[model samples]
Target chain A: MRFIHTSDWHLGRTLHNQSLLDEQAQMLETLLALIETHEVDALVIAGDIFDRSVPPAAAVSLLDAFLDKVIQQLKVSVIAIGGNHDGQERLAFGARQMARAGLYIQGPVSASISPVRVDGKHGAAFFYPIPYAEPALVRHLLEDESIQSHQDAMAALLSKVQAHNSNGLPKIVVSHCFLDGGSESDSERPLSIGGADKITPALFTPFDYAALGHLHGPQYKGAEHVRYSGSPLKYSFSEQHQNKSVTLVDMVPAKAPDIRLLPIKPQRDVRIIEGHLDTLLAQGAKDPGRDDYLMVRLLDTHAILEPMAKLRAVYPNVLHLERTGLMQERSMEGPGRERMQKSELTMFEDFFNQVQGESLSGPQKALMSDLIASLHREAGQ
Target chain B: MRFIHTSDWHLGRTLHNQSLLDEQAQMLETLLALIETHEVDALVIAGDIFDRSVPPAAAVSLLDAFLDKVIQQLKVSVIAIGGNHDGQERLAFGARQMARAGLYIQGPVSASISPVRVDGKHGAAFFYPIPYAEPALVRHLLEDESIQSHQDAMAALLSKVQAHNSNGLPKIVVSHCFLDGGSESDSERPLSIGGADKITPALFTPFDYAALGHLHGPQYKGAEHVRYSGSPLKYSFSEQHQNKSVTLVDMVPAKAPDIRLLPIKPQRDVRIIEGHLDTLLAQGAKDPGRDDYLMVRLLDTHAILEPMAKLRAVYPNVLHLERTGLMQERSMEGPGRERMQKSELTMFEDFFNQVQGESLSGPQKALMSDLIASLHREAGQ
Candidate 1:
């Protein structure tokens, strides 16, 4: 059995408040091309299909279009599961009816993890979808009081799957979880604030392949069979250096699965640069990839006049700007306990200087003094 | 051919901030029973399936459950369309894929109107769905600059359906629009603010039957074959007296369609009661349907102490309250332009007197006087 494994599409997500719908559409097109080239039997989307519980309408439309092409046009079965970011009821709305079209969506976790059987060139492969669930939900569903963390929940869930797998068929487990030892990034939300949601690598040892989501980096832990396909696009500055890719797995009866990483090229790269404003402007003027999203850190100590406007003239996609050295100095120099004893006028001047990195001009000082006098006069009336 | 016609479901609607989901679910159950008893071949939902473009998740779940019962369990075809309240793209999402399961939803207006044919005891009947469209959209789709009003848009749409009906099959046109001479209520939104959306009754002359929506009251428009099924529940107080129903239509080739109105009993009746506060309380304690949603008009001249709370003790669903005689007097005696020259203290006293329907007590008057003195003192600082 051969299949394309992808996860963390995060559709309807915005990077620096810029819509990624067009880029997401382009990436799905590339995914389709890869599927056709590899002649994959089925498509497995692990989870986090939508960025949020209630996504915008355009996101729904895009997912619908992609499913129509893959399931209806290509005649391939698709197995999708709901992640932590998904609304379980919304995702599970029409799962039963949609299954008739070869689109299987598992939104809620249950005690019996039913495996969907699909035919391939090798033999029949059983695909098990384990959607995201909390410890309380798992405990309630299994009627077990010992389940406490996400690790315990997965253990309880897998025990049921193990009990049902008496046939010893080739099995693939698709799940959305934060596996232990996976690298983290800024854009990926922590599964649990208390740091109790991580699952050990040994829990996935029984499956021929474990397609995982939630950690936005393509990697493996301990064994080659378990992997995180990662996000298709760079969602934050911290992820600028991570290589985004999807996994394709090939399996045969009584043998280890073969895996290949298919790299996806984003429409525009996310880049970060640090230098003096003048030097950065010079580089921006000559750069060929000017449309890439950029976060710039300026080393200059003094404030520049409308630096963002100047930078955007040459690099239209500059999303962020920072003067880290000067900002640190201003923070250290801010008013302390003496601020309460100082007059309002003196405090205002200090705040203005701190924000703009300069003292008030002569005319501006006069304006402030006059405004304060008027306020006092009004109070005295 | 025999079918059940219903429209303007407005699922997820609220009456005075109270959710109508339970009532809607009960009504759907009644509708399902009706379908079974009548042995209906298809279910036609003209438009307005949801109350808002972005319905709550619970509403989506309810609608999905209803569809699962009707389409998957009973094996009946469902044909729905987008109304002005629906987000067209959202409603139309997954339409092509859902059609395989005998559920059809049409959104956006176009020149090509595809008819879904269902086999019935009377031979074959073709159902043409014309979703609501603006005048501008109609003009753009048909490539006709002359389409300027909703009437023109409907005319242009019907022309296409007429051209497609050369097979001489029994045709039923399902649409969502306001027809001329139809009596409307407060709950129904005007299709167009300029009144250009009202279509003439003659537009349905070519079809064997026209199942319409948008009006809350079920009534025939000029002919027996053309009718509105009305909403299944009272959405507003204005519709409290209107009988809510679904239309059951029976048709054969080359004959006038037979229509029957099946009245639906609401979970709780919306009622209006007017009397003195004492008299209302006496009546509320004795009424059998005390749980009915009530709008009360109290005729007391003096202010009642927490009237809403008092009424709710017996009538738990009292959604609105109006102090009729005192409010009328207050409105008549409101301050006019001449009061602008009056002192703030006098204005405050008058406002308090009007709201309370009595002058300030000794302690209250002294507190107000002291508050005014403190304000003056602060200004003099």
Candidate 2:
């Protein structure tokens, strides 16, 4: 049995207030082509189908169109589950009816687990889906007071799956969780504040392959059977260095599975560049990184007039700008409360220099003194 | 052929800040019972299934449960359309897949409108759904620039339906729009500010029956076959006099249809009452209108203390209160801006008398004067 493993689509996501819908649509087009070329039997989407619980209408339409092409046009079975960012009830709305079209979605943890069994050349391949659920919900569902963390919840769920699988078919476990030793990124919401939500890879001892989602980096644990396919697009500057890919797994009965990574190229790459304003502009004139979304940091010590507008003239997609060297120096200094206790005129001058990176002119200082005198007169009256 | 015609469910609607979800659930229970008792072959929901384009999760769950029972358990077909209040794209999502389960939801109007044909005891019953579409959408869809008003759009849709029916069948037209001569209510959003959306009832001459929505009053338009079944519950104080009901139609081939009204009783009745404060309080003490949601008008000439709270002490569901007589008298006078020109002491005295319904005592008047002096001193400083 061969299947394509992917997760964390995060449809309707925006980077620095810019919509990624177009890039997301292009990524899905590439995915469909890969599925056709590989001739994969089943598709596994672990979790996080949407960026937020309530997505905008355009996101809903995009998902609808994508599913129609994959399930109805390609005629492949898809197994999906809810992630922490998903509203479980919303995702599970029409699961029963959609199941007829080979779209299986599980939202909540149930006491009795059912595996979607698919007949393959190596016999029946059983796919077990464990959707994202809170410890409280798992505790309530199992009526077990000892389930206090995500690790405990997964242990209980795996035990149920173990009890149900008496046929000993080639088993695969699909889940949305933060496995131990997986790299983290700024965009992925941590399952818990502390590290209490991490689960060990050993929980899948009986399964041939474990397809995991949560981290934004495509990687494996100590063994090669368990892997994270990662998000298809970079969602933050912290993920700019990571190559996004989907995992393709080939499994045969009573044998180890073979895993391969198929890299996905986004429509516009997210890149970071740092230099003085003049040098950056000269580089932009030569290369003109107009298509890539960019974050530029100015290394010049002095202030530059409207640097963002100037850089955007060449790089239209520049999303963020900052004076990193000056900012770091300012952070090392303590709070400026004593300076604020001085005369209002001095305080205004300090604020002006801090923001614009220049001291007040003689004329500007004279105008400020006049305004302060009038304010004192008004108070005296 | 027999069918139940209902519309403007306005699920997730609230009245006077009170959630009507409980009442809506009860009303749906009654509707299901009626569907079974009448043995209706199909259920027609004309439009406005939800109060807003995006409903809360609970409202979605209620609609889901209702559809599950009707389409899955009872094996009845439902044909629905989008209204002006609905988001057309959202309502049309997954419509093609859902059609397999006998749930047909049409959002935008198209040139080729297909009928959901069901064989009845008499003949084949053809149900054509024309969802709510603006003039601009209709013009673009048909590529006819002449379409301007809603009447023109409806006329174009009906003509298409006329062309499609080559054989003699019992035809039923389902739509959501404002028809001519129908009574209006506050809760029913006006399709247009000046009745520009009113379409003549003669447009339905080609069909055996027209099941309409949009008007919250259950009434016919010059003929028995063309009707608005109204909403199943009163959504506003202005609609308190209406007897909420659903229309049941029995049709046969090439003949006039038989229409009947099945009244639905809500869990709590919305009522309005008028009397002096003391008389209303006494009445409330005896009858204790705790079950009914009430609106009260106090006819007393002077202000009363905490009338809303006092009334709610006996009638827990009293949602609104008004001093109608005094309020009317006050409005008859000119703007209060003129009274503000008087001395501060005099202004305070008048305000005290108006609210308390009596002049202040000597000690109270002295305290007010002293407080005014202190305020003036503070302002000077």
Candidate 3:
């Protein structure tokens, strides 16, 4: 049996306020090709199906189009779960009825996640999909107070899953979480937002393979059998050097699964370059992939007039620009550190002073402060 | 064959920013009772399944729950369509697969709508669901430039639908539109947003019955069979006098449809009361439906201090307040008309001057004007 494992399709994501939907749609098309070429029996999507809980209607349509092809047209079985970024209950809308049609989507966290049994050429394999949920919710559902962290939550969930594995066929665990040794990328939220804890991969010993997600980078945590397929595209600038691919798992009953990293041909590549402004513009003019998403780090010492405008004319997709080398400390330290410590109101006040050549009036300051505070409150949530 | 017709659910709508999700959920549950007790074979949600294109996740969940119970649990056939408020392509997701499960959702408007044939004890019947769409889109899709108005759009669409009715079984047309002669209410948007350009009910002549939507009152525009089920709830104060109900159409081939208005018991009634401030507060304290949504119109000539707060203390759900009698002309004419005529920036400027005891300085005014203009541009869209 062959299964393509993938996750964190973060549909509807934007980079530097530029829409990545075209790129995302292209990625899904690439996935369809891989599914056909790989001769995959089942598709495992380990969550974050949407970038936000309430995804844009376009994103929803994108996913619907992709899944409809895979499940209906391709006639392939799809096993998906709710991720940290998904609206769990919302994602699980047709879990019950859809299963009859070979689409099994795990919704809300339950005490016992029933194994979805799919019989391949060799034999039937049971897939235990552990959807993401808060530790408190998992604890309440399991009626076990020991579930205190993400690790504890997963462990508790797996224990319940282990109770149904008496069939002795090839079993797989599909989940979305940050394992203990998994690497983090710039696109991922940190421990506070992501709740990264000691979620060791050892909990999956009862299963043959563990399909994982959450980290954008694809890697095995503690065991090769347990792996992350990684995201289809580079979401952040830090991910530029990373090779993105979907994981292919070819398996037979009671045997080690053959894992292969299948590459996806992205329509546009994300590139970062560091050089003098004049040199970069000259190079960009001669470059083949000038349309690629770029973050240019200028090394020029003195002030360059209208650098971004000049760079954009040459490299139209330049999403970010920063000054490095001689300008590193000058730009990042001193005033920048002080600037970072200031409230948005103070920054706005400074900008107003610079533009208008006058300090903000008392009432204007009050309005600015209230607006800034409201924005902060909303962004915090 | 008994089909229950309902529409304009406006799920996720707020009455003056007060969440109607709970009330909406309750209404769906009440609908479940009608479906169960009346033994409904099919459900036709004409349109406006949601109030916005991207509804809150909670609203999606509520709809999932209601549709799940009806489609999966009760095993009833549901034919819903996208409305002007709905994201058409988004709502049409899985339209093909869902049809096998007896849930037919019309996605984007097509050149010709294929009738879904459902067999009942009285033989097979055809359901033609013409989902809400734009006139220009319909014109382009049909390759007919003659479709300029809503009336022309419906006529062009119905001609295509008529070609499929040679089977002679009972046929019904389900659609969402503003018919020419239908009465309207405040809750429903004006023609600008709703596109009410003389879509006469005569366009539905080929069908045995027309299950209509968009209007809030349950009534027939031209013929008795061409009826609007109305919204299940009173969305605005203007609809308080109208009775809300679901339409049950009992049909047989070559026989007239017996249309019955089935009532759904609501949890709390919407009310509008008028009286002097003190007397109203005293009456509100003793009113049985103090917990219900209220729009209290004060008759007192003098300004009342913290009137909303005072009213809320006695009647917790008092949603809106107004004044009549001695307050009519003063509240609606002169300054009110002048206020409407002035720009939002000008109004804010006057308020700022009155509250702060000083006119805004130049830069402050510029900032205020920019913010107000931005808000207006967004709200206008």
Best candidate (score: DockQ): 1
- Find the candidate with the highest lDDT and give its number: 1
CA lDDT, candidate 1, residue B335? 79
Tell me the tens digit of each residue's lDDT in model 1 across A1-381: 889889989999998898889889999999988888888889999899999988788898899889889988887888999888877667776676787777888988888897888886545688889999999999998889999999999988887667676377788899999988889989887888978989998999888899998888899986999988988888899998998988988986677898999999988888888888888889887898888888888886554557789789988988998877556545555475333223445657767876787898999988887777777667763
Model 1 residue runs over 4 Å out of place are: A110-112, A165-167, A324-381, B328-381
| TM-scores for candidates 1 onward, in order | 0.86, 0.85, 0.83
Complex DockQ, candidate 3? 0.27
Candidate 3, residue A74: how far the Cα is off, in Å: 0.9
Which 10 consecutive residues of model 1 chain B have the lowest summed lDDT? B336-345
| Model 2 quality (TM-score) | 0.85
For model 3, residues B304-355, the per-residue Cα lDDT tens digits are 4567898899989989988574356345545643344344555567667657
How well is each residue in A236-321 modelled by candidate 3, as lDDT tens digits? 99999889999999876556889999997678898799899878878887899899999999886544556789899999999999
Estimate, for each residue in B1-381, the C-alpha lDDT of model 1 and write its tens digit.
Answer: 899999999988998998999999999999999988888889999888888888888988899889999988888888888888777677776677777888888877667997988876546688999998899998998899999998899998998778885477788999999999999977887888978889998998678999888888898897988889998889888888999999999986567888899989988988788889888889888898889888888887655557899899989999988889666655555475322222445557767876778888889878887787677677762
Identify the superior model by lDDT, candidate 2 or candidate 3: 2
Candidate 1 clash pair list: none
Docking class of 2: acceptable
Using DockQ, rank the candidates from best to worst: 1, 2, 3
